[model samples]
Target chain A: MKRTITLTVNNRPGVLNRITNLFSKRNYNIESITVGHSELEGVSRITCVVNVDNENIIEQITKQLNKQVDVLKVTDISDQAIVSRELALIKVLSTPNTRSEINALIEPFRATIVDIGKDSLVIQLTGESEKIEAFIELIKPYGIKELARTGTTAFLRGTQRTSNSTKNISIV
Target chain B: MLQETAFTKMKADNKPISGSELLLQALEKEQVEVIFGYPGGAVLPLYDKIYDSKILHVLPRHEQGGIHAAEGYARITGKPGVVIVTSGPGATNIVTGLTDAMMDSLPLVVFTGQVATGVIGSDAFQEADILGITTPITKYNYQVRNIEDIPYIVKEAFYIASSGRPGPVLIDIPKDIATAISEPPEEKEINIPGYQPTLQPNYLQIRKLTEAVSSAKKPVILAGAGVLHAKAAAELKQYAEQQQIPVVHTLLGLGGFPAEHDLSLGMAGMHGCYTANMALYEADLLINIGARFDDRLTGNLESFAPNATVAHVDIDPAEIGKNVPTEIPIVADAKEALKQLVAQEGKLPEHKEWLTQLQNWKKEYPYFYDNTSSLKPQKVLEMLFEKTKGEAIVVTDVGQHQMWAAQYYKFSKANRWVTSGGLGTMGFGLPASIGASFADRDACVLAILGDGGFQMSTQELAVIKEFNLPIKIIILNNMALGMVRQWQELFYEGRFSHSKNPVQPSFVKLAEAYDIKGYEINSVEEAETILNEVFSNNEPALLDFRVDPNENVYPMVPAGKGSHEMVGVKP
Candidate 1:
């Protein structure tokens, strides 16, 4: 099973290394990870997608991640109603003859041609991972010269928070 | 005049202190009385402060010995052990001891010197990324970036090490930080948001446990090191007696329950006794307190206590359902949980039939070995137990001799039996015993070692001689790596494969060179007399017993086999 776990951790040096080291030590396969500053000051939110066998393994992973000192909160948002998105920039081989065809194909998907080179077109797509995969598949015939993807980042669909308000909890 | 007045005012307000001096003050505030340490280049500043400090420092010949000694001190005193060592090799040397302490859940606060904050990543001389290396092994670790953070870091390190499920915590201090001067940070409550460990069990879960206990026809209590760590041995004994439940100990839990008690079914696991293993196999309910179901104890989880409903009570929530599927989970301190069980009102069923069955199994398959012909390692421990009356704090190195000691030398109280149960490090016994001897000067501390293991830390003999520690060092000389040899004999068709030590130094001569009394027992006939002569005085002594080379520990549940499928049981 594939699970997405979100963690709110202290914004300190080597925090990411500690989190990654934990996953590696437990032999958990990390499919993707995205980290950035959270809403709170001096705190960071990390969203990690891991491959595990069953719910028990995810439970173990969450418990282990929660054991790290810098990790303030761990929430398995896999089963929650989440609004998730991933941005990918694909530079595809294009000729003057096929530029119009690529633009017409991308317009329905809401993907924009951010940069147009003499021989290539860089398409910027921000959507669910499946949508990006489909867009890439359609453009594969035009030859994908380069591709860059920012791993999935997510949030709960409504006002429900993944972590409790940090007003009562000490940051350091 | 203005500069002089400002300096005087600053001194009156809050004096600036070097990081080393600040660390000493923090340690004093923590009420640390002793430190097991070895000095080195990176730690010179700290060592200079230690020279004037009131803390007693016992310097071992090596950093490994120092850390193991610290473990021994922690185990016996029920206090978090404190250790200080230098950078790179000095820090790396204690890696095995750190891992050992971590696995056994012993509380230790180890301070290692880093090269310098600027040179940490430059691969400077005597520099190592200790925090990176120890991240997996430590409960938590910190690299002090600011001199002002020393006091808080030290306080937090000790708190984290000693609280909840105790384990080793490391603090790496850079050289420049140690030498820098700064005003101490204001003291505050040590609060780690993610590190809150549950100390109280749910009342409903206690009700569930009591209900299961009252209804169980064949119930067994599996106790581990947590019982000792929580200082809940008395509560555990009280609960077991009140409920009439048979108790089985994990390897490290040997002393958590009195072995002489009728309800006590010695140790259970791969090398556990026949009765203990069988009781675990047949129990209808296994009330595991403070024990993680390690593979060695479970022996194929599918067949382990298959008929039982497991109620696991541990301080660490992760351990409850880690190796075994726990039915009723209570995440709390062992002492608190046991106290609640004792206080609960319930009509518990008398397991007379189960008790009788366990008693019969115990009598039929008691731990035995043929001591008629040659010197058996079991006889050595048995004789030691008889002579010491099971009062000595016995420490052991890993291998066959360790198993024999766990089997024959029964401990009646917690913290009496100390060994590297989790990591099974070979060189642990001698240094650990050195630490144990320091816990109480009058008490007899015994270090039992195998020939192969004895040589691993024999350099520590210098420490014994230097301190004149009254320790009884016994080396069971099988002339081989006994456990590996036994495994190879059983699983590899007698292919020795470098298991036998063909060349070895004379341990007696080695002891004599260190100015310690050394005795040799070549046969079973002289074992008692030699033991008497060694224990007759208070001076430190070493005994080399040339035991049978081919002896094997029996009642083993072979790897990947079920607990019920133990081989080598005398039927």
Candidate 2:
């Protein structure tokens, strides 16, 4: 199964290298990773989606990540109530006849046609990964010229902070 | 070089000192007494500072020897070993020692020099990615980019290296940083919010463990290096004796309990005694304190202690239920948990039947080898133990001789038996023994090495002679890698391959070359006389005993086999 893990690390030099080195050393397969400054000052949050075989691997990964010197916190919020989103810019071939049909298909999905070209239309979609996939499937018949995804990033739905332990002592 | 004199001139001025001065001050603050090192070009600044400081510096012939000697010092004194090495090969040389310390959980603080920060990635002379190479092997590592961060980083390195499940920590110092000007650090505890280790055990869990111990019909305590690291030997002994439980140790756990005590079952695992292995196999409750259940100790996981309800106590939470399932997992220091467990009331009756069964097995299947051959390795250790009256601090290199020493020499106290238990580094004994000797000059220190392993770091003999350390070095000349040769004989149709040593160096000549006392013995009759004379002299000496080359460590549990299926036991 694919799991999303968010790691809060101290904003210090060589931290990213350390995190990536740790993953490679432990043979953890990282599918995608997105890092940016978190709400906490002088700290960065890394959202990583990795492919793992079992729950035990996730536990080991989290424990190992917690052992890193710069990593302040690690949480596998994969099973929690989360708001997950992905952004994709997909270019699809649109003839004069198929342009209106494409508009009709993306009308309910709230996707926007960001660019119109002579040979194709570039559609920008930002939603849950499943919604993005649905939009792509509908537009596939029009022939996708190119596609780029920012990958899935997520956070808990409530005000619960990962740094503070919740009452739920789930999987230790 | 001028910075040292300037810092000394302005010592009372409250002026900012050079980075080297700050480094020395941090060492003084930590109360470090000794540093094992081999200086080089990149570390000249630190070396100059060291010369001005009051700390004792031990210069080994090689960088690897320096690290192992530091390890020896750490193991004996219960202090974090400190090392200073230059960049490139100097930093890379300590990899084996670092891995050994990491595997065995020894506390070490190593400082390595790097090229100037500007030239780090430019392929400058004597530059290497030391932090990158050592990240996985060390407990924690840091690269000192800013000279101002020196104090905080040093404090953090020491804290991490010596706290909860201690291991090696490395700090890479760029040349420019060390030469830059620095100021005195504020007197306060360095706050690292991410590094708090849990020391106290959960009382509820301790209660559960005590209950299980009280009700267990056949209980055994399997202690490991964690007991020694936590300084919990007293608590462990009391808990076992009060509960009338037999204690078996992992190889590294020797001396954690008195080996001669009736409740002690010696060591357990592949080359462990029959009594200890049998007790582990038959126990109804196994209380493992600080042991990680390494493959050598556990054998087949599915069949290991099948009848036991395990209660594992360790400082590292990741070790719990990692290899084997646990009924009660208490994440805490072994000493604290054992103290709490011992405080609980209720005197459990002695399991006389189980104890007698273990005794019978011990008498029936005792560790034995053919004694008809001349110069038996076990006989050599037995004689050494007799000569020393089991009162020496013995360090060993890895091989059959190491196992022989483990089985034959009785270590009655913790920290007295030092060996490379985890990484099994070949060149550990001589340097480590030299380090141990420095820890206590009055104590008899012995280095038990195989012929092949003794050659690996014999260069340290020069350092030993230079220091006039009265370390007795014994080389059991088996002329082959006995352990691997035995494995091939038993499991691989006896294809010796590279195990045999066709050509060998004359160790006595090497000792003579170093101007140390040297002796040679190849027959059983000469062992007592030679050992007695050499040991009585109380000087650094080497004795090469040409033991039976075909000797093998027996009472072996084939790899991945259950401890119950030990082979090579004689009637």
- Among the numbered candidates, top lDDT falls to 1
Report the number of the highest-DockQ candidate. Answer: 1
Off by over 4 Å in 2: A91-105, A116-121, A133-146, A159-172, B1-12
True contacts kept of each: 0.80, 0.47
lDDT, candidate 1, at B456: 90
Query: What TM-score between 0 and 1 does chain B of candidate 2 receive?
Result: 0.97
Name the top TM-score candidate: 1
Pairs that collide, model 2: none
Considering only chain B, report the TM-score of each candidate against the true chain B: 0.97, 0.97
- How many residue pairs collide in each prediction? 0, 0
DockQ of each: 0.64, 0.55
- Per-residue accuracy of model 1 over B412-470 as CA lDDT, tens digit each: 98988889988889999999999899887888989999999889999899999999998
* Model 2: docking quality category: medium
